[model samples]
Target: MSSKSTQTQFDKNMEFGNDTTELIRYITKGDGAGLAYQWLSTLVDGFGHRMVGSDSLEEAIDFLVKSLEEDDFDDVHTEEVPNLPNWVREDDNVEIIEPRHQRLNVLALGGCEPANITGEVVVIRDLDNSKFVNVSGKIVVTAQQFKGYPQTVKYRQSVKLFESLGAIGVLIKSVTSFSINSPHTGSGAEGARIPAASLTVEQADMIDRMFQNGEKIVIRMNMKSHSENHTTTSRNLIFQITGAFRPVNWLSHLSFSGDQQHVNLFKMKRLDEIVHLLNRNGILLGLVNNPSQGDVRFWAKDGIPSVNYIPDKAIDYYFYFHHTGGDYITIFKDGDLEYTASIFAVLGHIIANMDNWGPA
Candidate 1:
């Protein structure tokens, strides 16, 4: 609205005021309801766990580029980000050799060194104190402990603690309390020389019980991982609707910009995880445990008001699908995708029309 352009040119494509309301209403009704959901579903189903440096992820990015271009955005492109940690999971096997022959469900943590070791597991139920038992030449096992992700993740990040004690490997209990034999994968073991992986909560609990009963819990872990620490290249997709011309105040969100000032919260996919992790350790960096862990902390650090754009409607208790094998499109309810799309589209429209956001 600020720019004076010829009416016949008619190419600004900016809308404001009641036009925003009408556009939002348009996405909710009839065919528009399912647009976002459809695109998301197609991506997930076609790509199937698109990890960095993988061919599937690259192909998926290409797919997104085409989709956004078809939608006629002002500009749609991917900025190549080099030197991303690309630790490929070659093959892993965790079997209880001493007690029985049960292969536990496991996922290798990113940046874990390639290793194949069969050692007794030293179960540490409470990681707060562990001076009693000698973990030298053994594997360390920790649990989620119902303390939410903030507290639970410390066990995963404590690879050096166990390694200093001569522990050869580490196995952390997944972030979710509820488990149906799903191993959650994450990246906290970067630059670690020893191997690390996540085991299901059920199996971790069983290990705890055995340790309590004075049983020699011996497990063999054979994991193979290839690290491409600074060699691999991936992309950050950038697309936006052109806003009305009133100085264009933009809302903040953490990105893969690698700006040390801002934490990266871009990889997190669940609103449930974000909500549950908030307000745990009092009031530090939005109160979500550590600044290195949560992505939303940097915005808070800069005094820029920000919100997690993810939805909170009918959130799952376990977030079982997130970063797990069950993350495919089969779990979504009828019109779930469409409804979420509508909400996002509406929000985008509002932002495009806004004069400015945050501080003056």
Candidate 2:
């Protein structure tokens, strides 16, 4: 991979030293559990729907700026930019104009031209150039079919294509489960977007059946879906953290074999020694995995393999802790019951008996 990408990737994975963890833990404990829960709850709840250019987006920005500032973040800011048009469903309705008249469900397509008059519907097998003679000045109804989004949406824009041939409106087979005469609407774009709507599958089937039976099926559609030019804007917020005695230390050489069960023994032993050592010297040894291993290279094989401890996100920290539960061996080390390695076997063998067991 390129050095820039590698560096960009590395910057995200790195975290602080033991002092950082101690500091975080101390801060959390000092604030009490209730306050912590309240902070998180407010952060998620106050944001609401953050869709660009919407009221929710503005509210979320103000909430973040205030919360981060209160949380002691030195600088918090937002970058503004124009947002895309957000179409919404306004109103819709559909009805069979002939052949056992009935109301069918329908919806308006976004960004479509308004209908001057509720037009009559005409059932057609297809809308190729050849069908223009019979479809002019009437709503064309047909079974909608497509393979994907952009492709499927062609039916929604069928009205505009038909309009070029002097057609009025387009009625599509509702692309939904169970026909309730209900129409579903969606956004569409064109030179001069035309009004479009959908009918339930059942209603579509009835219309097609009439055509197959040599009977003309007609329907009336009244849909209200329009778009207006509006200034849309959105915001992007950013924050950063700071520390004084920042240090980067590389830990290596310590190695072991066996499943996590065995690893826990080593972990307990190290934790006990480190904590006692720290307490005695008025210094702290933070037990943390090397954060640099988060690079994509760690997962990519074949190259010179990096053995730095994988970042916490790569491994299930909670699972490891739970799996090691009750397996830890504690010892009276320097007047404190610290975690130790009394339960683990050396090279998978039980050697030293009870009394012979002493600090190695």
Candidate 3:
């Protein structure tokens, strides 16, 4: 068959005939490809970091709602969710006053109370019970190895434990395995109020070495971090696409009669088909095998099976850029957003047209 005839036959097989062909071609080849990138740019560049309770976050939510409305999506709205305490770091300084006078680069951990202290630095190589003593009224320094974030986060979030022991302040080495003098910052102790900061691995190692050599290591830390306890309203943006077929009460009754395992298997099959369709359309390259957690867990608890897809290359850069000052629009490559948006559009179209998508 001629190329034109082959193309014509392929178009006829599409479920929506010319409409499907036009939509797919427009998404893959037209300006629809850049939609994701454009939206991301507006969110990151225009509104800045969307930290909870921050003005930027509220603005971002508004932007998403408006964007969805402009796209003519049905039922575009925001749902209020619990807010986190607003924490901001104003200024911080760390200096080694003993053994040798030198300054160190640091970033105050989020939600850490502000404090200024000059005390003898004690290095704890591990979180063993034996290391808990003699930490009173002294600066506690702990080394962090490159365990996954979930596994190693306890070291940073232990401010309450350290505070109860009368420790004046806490300094944790960056948890990341790779860094160029970057000090990562994350949530501080949940309930305890104490000053906490992260130091570059090199700085932490030097301090540890000095302490191990029996050198009198005194350090002065000045941090101006602050947190507001008041709760603020936040929102989750949701956009829905109405399916073509109407739901029937009998279908839900029949669905519950099947073996539970079979129901799960069918859901997995549908998910696999969706993934395959995106892959065949050249939207997805490969799967990311890393175990990372995100908002998908919340959706799962609500009985919704959601997939979190990050670009293949994004998995490598996630630690370095995510939740850091390095998270900016510049990190995204050209066509990255466009491709992602196209994939989502195609998936939404397929699901919306399904003959039987059980239960509301």
Candidate 4:
């Protein structure tokens, strides 16, 4: 992948005229690198975890709207959206009490019901019904290796399967491929809400080993997590850079900064063009065939062609810090943010300036 070769290919296949070229050049050379980092710093520093329905989320939305307005962006506004059930974990503790007392690291899953239980730990190696020994009145510990998030997360996210078998509580191994003694938190599916939490891969493995060694493991769990039934309003901040030309309403390209998985190649030709453009500018980016399941899914469902781009090397950043107490501005490097901002700005400017930039 020589830069000269990429540039030659990009020039030969160019469809948009001089305006698009000029816009892309200006964006790539300009000092818009600070924009993304500034926004990220403000969000993480000013408002701590912006969970849905939390005051932090509202404050973050207000901050975004104000920042966009200050930058003189066109159509900067907020739209009210129905909020999901807000779950708050005030206090939670899980400890091994019987087989040599040791406190374990745990994070209560969102939407999990609160409970206090003391029971022998039962390890479920597989989901096979035939191998099921009666796990009645026990704390079930299960670990599933990461195949993919959607495929493997079901064992942990759905509590009904464990509850129906008379499990008092549940402890699932974190979904991440690696862990630094950190537990990840995510929402559970709509089902029998049970006292459920996530344990680091190491911790879960240790528990499983103890169960296998004919050691009786007695664990005590105290979870104060709860949720409000009443719905509240949340805001989605929108900032539009109105195009100079008449915008095409039929197609759209979306780049999400939320999740690490890339998805949905609605317009493959346009994607190829963008990839070439980025590569020509010496910005190495790749597209993967994975379901993003990010916010872009909603746009795609509404009959618009959309695509999502997650930054390279974002997987470690997301798993280690995102949605956890460690998600602070300090976790990000200045150079990385600058590169991300420049690439996004270039892509956005080119798309905004292209004539008849819509679905064929």
Which candidate achieves the best TM-score against the true structure?
A: 4
For residues 179-240, what per-residue lDDT tens digits would candidate 4 score against the true structure? 77888767662455568888878999999888899999999999887777786788767667
Worst 10 residues of 1 by lDDT: 276-285
Identify the superior model by TM-score, candidate 2 or candidate 4: 4
The C-alpha lDDT values of all candidates are 0.66, 0.47, 0.67, 0.69
Candidate 1 lands at a TM-score of 0.77
Candidate 3, poorest ten consecutive residues by summed lDDT:
248-257
lDDT (tens digit, per residue) of candidate 1 on 1-360: 123422211123342323434544556565566676777778887888788889999999999899888988656889999887777877788888877778988988877878888898888877777657688899898854767666567787888778877889899888776678898877767878788898898989988888888888888888887686457899988876776554343333423323432333422222222222221211112212233424566665664443443334322443566567666777777755554454444445544454333221
Instruction: Tell me the alpha-carbon RMSD of every candidate.
Output: 9.1, 18.5, 5.9, 4.8
Q: C-alpha displacement of 234 in model 1, angstroms? A: 1.4
- Model 4: lowest-lDDT 10 consecutive positions: 256-265
- Please provide TM-scores, in order, for all candidate models, with all chains considered together: 0.77, 0.44, 0.79, 0.83
Please give, for residues 44-114, the per-residue lDDT of candidate 2 as tens digits: 46664344456777887898798888978645778777656654445556677666678776656555655
Ranking by lDDT: 4, 3, 1, 2
Q: How far in Å is the alpha carbon of 84 misplaced in model 3?
A: 4.3
In candidate 1, stretches whose alpha carbon ends up further than 4 angstroms from where it belongs are: 1-21, 244-293, 296-305, 309-318, 358-360
Between candidates 1 and 3, which one is better according to TM-score? 3
